[model samples]
Target: MTRPLLSLTNVTVAAGRAATAKPVLDGVSLSLAPREIVGVVGASGSGKTVLSKAVVNWLEPPLTMRSGEVLFEGRDIYALRGADMRILRQRISYVGANPMGALDPTLPVGAQIVEKMRAVVPGTSRRTAERRIIELLDAVRIPSARNRFHDYPAQFSGGMMQRALIVDALVTNPVLLVADNVTQPLDVTVAAQVIRLMKELTTTFDTAVLFVSSSLPVAREACSRILVMDEGRIVEEQSTDDLVERPVYPYTRELIRQTPKIWGETVSTSRHDDQREVVLSLRDASQSYKVRKKTGFGGVNLVRAVRNVAFDIRRGDSFAIVGESGCGKSTLMRLLCRLELPSSGQILCAGRDIATLKGRSLLEFRGKLQMVLQDPFGSLPPRTAVGKMLEGPLRTHGWRVEARIRERVLKVMGEVGLPTELYEQLPLGLSAGQRQRINVARALVLEPEILIMDETLSALDQAEQFKLLDLFEKLQKEYDLTYIFISHDLAMVRKACNRVAVMYLGEVFELADNERLFFDPGHPYTKALLSAMPTLEPRRYRPEECLLEGEPPSPLDIPAGCSFRSRCPQAVDKCSRLQPSLTVRERQDFAACHLVLPPTASGGIGGVGTTVP
Candidate 1:
């Protein structure tokens, strides 16, 4: 019976001139009550972003509002002008996907937010603004809010920057907030915390929210009601529980089906074989960098990126390394492929120390171990044709004849599911999935035994990811290839990887087969990550019990003892005095936690945490 805080009726948005406009949002209608959270779910190019931008009238040129009425407090927002429009705009805030680009690089993040606050609120003293900003920052769970306020945007991590952006959006105490894919770039734990924070803040501030995301599970976590968008139209709308349990539209059903499951039936069969030859191995390998301090002093800080990492990849194994951002997954990937020599220890490729190799030996190592980098578009050369791009690796490795090179390039392209017709086409207008396939083809052209996929599928949508995963499975079987996946996508890992290594603060917390790690993890951090993962199935680990608080300690100043103990909930007295080494918890499972008792003990397995039905 309460009046809706915002309403859109028969809203239609289109691109280009009137004579040749194409619809982006077709007859979309929705209403948000006070303090209510509504979600819009769809795949890429589904017009979800357009609808969010339309709510705040932030759409630019080429995006024309064809027909619609957007009402704020029962008043037509489009009819308002000048001061009225400015005031209305101030009452609605939008937070986008990229928090790093939102704040000015030249100014302290807090100063930029305060500047906006004064501009909109008017007559607010600097001291009062600072107090309010810091309060909101703390409310969003940024540790040492006062100290971090003076830190530059570059100083804050991805999760911290996102929380700061939320603080900026809420500083005005708007009646409505439009969050567009804000959590897409964050880690699972960080995303869960942000979602929980938004729920609490919506109640505290009595503000409605329009949560837009490509991920259905993420939307389900934060919203009461969901709207499924497809090709600029609202295909279906229902309560979150009812919609997820029984969807009405085909697209919605497909979206639900495409969402990777974590606790469901195993998708990838066991491919682990200890008898197989070890393709790659690491022995106490470590890496670090000396970064200069921001104070213009001559002193520098040592960033311990990777420390004492030990792992082995057998032929035909699908191994994964998963952790939050800055957890040394990337550094380990570099070490595995010999991009950088380890500061200490050894990285052995086929029983030969990679760091000791030079000239022809190094070239041979490069040929044997190829890498497919992240950022599909950025990794590819825009001007180069797809065929030529794929051929470069083959040419570098000595495929002399042009005819033979073209033949090999086309064959690799087919293996990655790229059409032959695209061989001569430039990568400029190609889709992200297509560009990534080219990268995969480029790596595969080398006929390498080991392939390191560094967040290779993160840029893709659910459907594209599924297709690529299937392709990888086929290639693995045919080529006898070994895969090293470095990613934050636990769902994909759950479905695709055979073995997993959980890392935290540059240390491997747990390593085990996929089933054991997912079903019965020994380390608390692994449990926390599983709990924080967004999935449709009922959670195995309760978030309230397992979710970590705040962020990991800075790599530059890692704590003594256990690096994870600072945020760990079950830390004991001994955890502060001594660090636990990787102890065998089961036949092949290893965990570095003080609380986990060895299987020989009466406590069968993982007595540290409880699970939910």
Candidate 2:
């Protein structure tokens, strides 16, 4: 048999300094051949990242590699000298999960990439290095590469920063690439493009990729072989097809079953929609920000973050705003909650114009609408005890009796599945899942009618996400609450939400019930987003054709007509001339696209490149 390009033989990683230290990775063995793609998948604390770090001797202090060898080209990497190891690492690149934190905040994003290339390839001319950097940036689908080359990491979105890190890893043209949950922060469309680029690299440069992610669907779509890790051990290893189709281990089977499929059995929402009371309504709602130019003369530009968008959330509706980053989902959320008054149009909350609400009315509105943010760690007060944090909100909102506040806090904590003992403990002492539950508990303390979950599940692992989803469903039914879930996870959205509004370039491109939206997307952008969603079936997956090309156009200077025309595959002359308005179709669907045929016409549902009129 041909020698494996990289191999880990009986690798064991233990925490702490003593012999009795707990093992995080227990005798985990794996191999990757040249030009091959292998995936390591597990729940959050399953030693997947630990084993990846061990492969390259990147384990930090207190996490020691005990016994076993990591062989690269038949040589033990652990046995190599410091200088030799450094040289070996040049041919083996690693891009970590926290791209923003991974990069130096002091330097420009472009400078960091250039510096890596210079450090790896000695004596390369500055002029040659710069040209190569631009090429790399362009290759990674960063729009207007030269113009944004000097931009800082803070300026880029989470997805943009991830692409920059991927470019940094590939700039050296390494023989082995180690990507650890690199696509976790990205939306499905952008993540698809990045995965497709990785696949192309394996073919173009004959690079072996060791991809580690908690998302099994992403792994199944990208990897040829997969290794399932449980508590400190590799439970099963098999071809991606076998692992997904016929897994021996229960853990592996559970993972396959838990992975959110984009298009599955349609969840019935007819029962929920029967009693329709307009809880929130957006009538020609629009939001615009006056952005000052970074360079040149000081002139203000009206960057329309959200265009003339109109939607309604009926009572107890799980309405979702699905879009990629910078697509105005959050901005619209702000508008809906009265955080930002819409520059144009009316936002009616329970038949009251929220934009005009003030003083006592605004305060009451705030109590009615509560928001749960994405980052559980950052959202919670680290120094504040869970009991104090949860009770303080009720006290501030005029719940005077101390006994009543304590009783309310404890009740909500139990509702969110958090242990009652954790009430007195600081948020820092809690696990990530526990912290998120605390966040949920904090929101529920007010007994809000409308709950806005802004990417709350994006930061969690699959298992943790499932738990939260279950809690969300349970809470929604019990409280008779309406949800406005702002997320990019299509599968999660499909499962949790009854209705979806596909946002793009600050416009509501498509709005439909979950079943029709997923199975038959009318708008091209909606179709692209659905197609980019990673699936367990490898043969059924097609990332290249569906992945959106290049980064979305800047909202600061959005194109006149169809804002999505530049990246859209089905763009025609008419699409460039005029923007399409959302037209209500049969089956209670709405789509803002010139290409989709009318609902009344024959062969209209899947007919692309056809005029509606």
Candidate 3:
């Protein structure tokens, strides 16, 4: 029998004060073989992250390992020092959940990668180092890798930053790689691309991987063996197929059930009719930005953020824009909220163009539409008390009566399941879920009819996300509100939304009812997105099923013809020469694809008889 490449023997970690400290990882043990991929999964605060850090001997202060041995290649890492320890670290790499924070913001992202690579491999020539950096960048599916190499971290989207981090980790071909929730912040399509890259790297380099994640489905997709942790203990360990098919642990079974199912599930039967009045409409709306190039020295580039987006948002309906990062979902939300005027087209609110509204009228229009940002803590002021935070919006909107404003704030706080006693406390003291609830309450305090949520649920745990979603449904009914959700989770979109629009490279590729879009997608990109949804089924879904080859093209220089042709597996000569117009195949359902046959030809989803608003 061969010895394992790495092993943790009876590890224990504790936090808080010395006398009253508590253990976060209690006597956890695991092993990994060379060329093997192992998954450590648990909810937040379950000690999964602690265990990963401890293995590399990187535990920070307040997290002391009491008694344990982290053996790599039969040598205890804690007992090594000086050059020995440095050599060991060079053979191992770590990538955390927050990709942008892991990078140096002041430097160009590619320069940082080159610096790290040269530091790991001493005396490497600059030419060799630069060549390797671009190779790794392209390997991780970053579009226009050469141009993006000179851009800062802020210039890249969340998903693009994650890909860059993955490239950094693999640039050295380390013996062991530790990835902690690297895909949690990315969209489904981007997550799938990252997972496929990891699979290929592990095989090609014979590298052992430790994948730590809070999502069981995501872990199952990327790992062969999995260890389940709960409240500082390893509760279960089994092969991926066995765990999914016959999970013996109660906690594992619960996690499997909580995983969202994208296919073969019953549709939402919420009593929202399609004949409601139109609350908002976009007529050939587009948005563009002027960006400065890196090498050209004051040269500028025009980037199209949203292009010719047209849709009708019905009153009392849940509408969603589903797409990967940098797909213009956020840009479209900004247009609807009047944060940016459309460059060429019209954004109509209540049958009037919002661009034409002046000072007082624009303020009034903003009062009717509010937005809930992606980061709850970032969006709210940390120094201000929750009560003041919620009240500020009311006061800004002209609720002069102090007593009435306080009463309304408390009411909305209760409506969002936030305890009234915590209103006087600062936001820094509250948990993530509590802060998110406060974000919702602030938006609700203004009594807005249209609420836009931009990736609001992407940062939460499974239980927290489910709780917030339930609250959204309840508030939507009580206030008769219309929701405009911008997200990348197709599973969540299927359950929470009634109508769906699939956007790709700043254009709507397909628009249809939720059931129709999920069951029988029309566009190739939409189909690829649906197929990439993570699941815990016994049989794994291979990446080849959907056949998306590369990342999306850059918005600065979108392809002349179909923007998706570069990645679409079904592309042809005609697809690259002509951009397809939005053709209606069914009532209120449209698709912009040259290859998507008409409904009559393929027995596709029949025309919806009811009108849209």
Candidate 4:
């Protein structure tokens, strides 16, 4: 009825040149209205990003529009040229697939945000923009807006930088926001906070969002309408609730059927639950990292990445550390892997003080504890082939025989469900998921007793993610391995971990069984995290169901009582002054909060044991 804010009819995009470039999108069509959010989702390489780019006229040549019509405010933007193209480009805001790479790394967060605002406003003074800059930063829940405004992109954490980028986009005041795979490698709780902020800002400013993700459940929960893509076409279009509950397309059905749920976790027998074969214990271990110079004094600049974090990962048990992004999850994993030495407290591995490792002992420790990083791009050598990548570590550990090394490489590849043909292919040729599998296979080749995965499955689609998680679980049992599963995906945490530890400002807030962590949280931050998990039930969420406001405290200047107190809904004045230690009471669990546990509480989990190395 009302002219659509944007629309695309019969759009088609190609994948490659010599590679047949089969039309990834086929005769797809859709329309959007003012102040509405549309989610685009499908398997990897299904042209979700391509379609979004085409709508904004950002599509490059070769993989041309081919045949299609994209209308912006009743005007075919595809037909616009010169001044018209420039005007349309300015009107549309696009946050790309990689948030980490989107901003100007050389620029300060404040400068980048203001630059966009100035470009459009013309003659708007920097002083006039600076006031709005503080508002924008605070609007996105960034802490220390005035003081940290001068910080460069590298100085901010991954999630903080993402908020900065979103603030940059908002400065343009565009009618439509297209976010492409922006939530990659971050946990669901943090992802929800971003989504909530986007939604609120969209409504306040009368903006529409084209939210693109590989996670169907996230789309289903966050979007009112959804575009289910395949190859390069809109395979199905329906209300988010209707499509998720009653999918008619085979591809959409497969997506729903294959997607791993991230809420209301099921019980699992993971490495952290093993009481009989405990391997590593953290006795009030804490790790603090200094922010890059220029933030302030060294003592003032320190971020307690993991504080008094305690948990036990038994042999063949999986203990998950769950929280939002920038919650110091990676630091905790590094502590277990011995990549980072603790700032205070100690860790005992198999009844020995691992803090004393050096020389050959450190090398031996490294060989004994392997890690899978969140980014395959960062982990893998771009020039190396998959097989050689796997073999290098084996040879470095003194494994002999050239053929045997190759043989061992192939075996691990197959174990991780990689094909033999992929062995000779360079890391450059593989997909994101394949590169991750190689990362996993490389770690597996070491035959380490403890495997620490730092949100490894967060980047992948449900199908790819489940396959790797299942494989890791099986291999843990087969090899008598231990796992420190660090993630904020509550569903995966529940399904993958036997016990759970919650972290904030470099300290373990609460440690318990996975069941209690999800269904019966004790710590206030833990409750907020569990409440923030996106649901696939296709029902409307109450206002209370939305995530907490305010950014996490600067790891540099953590509050005395509770690091999470700034964001905790149940925070009290006492919560502000007295730092809670990891205290065990009754036979329940270890919690860092002042709240007393019920003697006969039935909802949360028990037998959680203690925080270990």
> For each candidate, what is the lDDT?
0.89, 0.85, 0.85, 0.75
lDDT of 3: 0.85
**Candidate 4 lDDT by residue in tens digits, 1-613:** 7788998888766655545667766787998898888999987778887877877888776676667788889899878987777677567888875667777889887987787788766777999888888888888888788876898877777677777777777775789888887776556565777788778966787788989988887786568999888777777989988997899999888887666554423455432323477688888888776555653666335666776666666776687887776777777777777777888888998787798988888888778888898886788988887788898888888889998888888888888889999888888857778889888889989888888888787777776777777888778767887788877677677667777888776667887766555555567677777666666743222327435676676676676777777766566777788887765633436678766444344233553332221
Clashes of 3: 0
lDDT of 1 by residue, 1-613 (tens): 9999999999999897585688999899999998999999887788988999999988898898889899998988888888988788678999998888898999999999999899888899899999999999999999999999999999898889999999999888998999999888788999998899889877899888999988899999999999999999999999999999999999999999889888777666465457989888899999999998877779898999999999888888889999998899988988887878999989888899998999989999999888898788799989988888888887888789999999988888888888999989999878888889999999999899999999898777787888999999999989989899998889989989999999998899999999889998988899999999999999999998999989899998988888898888788887888889987776677899887766655355553332211
Per-model TM against the reference: 0.94, 0.94, 0.94, 0.91
RMSD to truth, every model: 2.8, 2.7, 3.2, 3.8
Ranking by lDDT: 1, 3, 2, 4
lDDT of 2 by residue, 1-613 (tens): 8899999889888887689998999998889999999999999889988888887779998898887889999999888986787678678999898877988888998888888888888787778877887887887778888977898998787788888887888777789999999888889888887888789889777788999999998997789999999998999999998888889999988887887765555565523354589889999999999977776798888888999999888988999999998899999989987878899999998899997788889889999999999888899888888899898778778899988888889899889998899878887756678888988888889999999999999888999998899899999989999999999998898788889999998899998888777766778788888888877643233445555877788888888788899988778998888988886665557889887755555455643223444
Q: Stretches of candidate 1 above 4 Å error?
A: 18-20, 294-297, 600-613
Which 10 residues in a row give candidate 1 its minimum summed lDDT? 604-613
Clashing pairs in 3: none
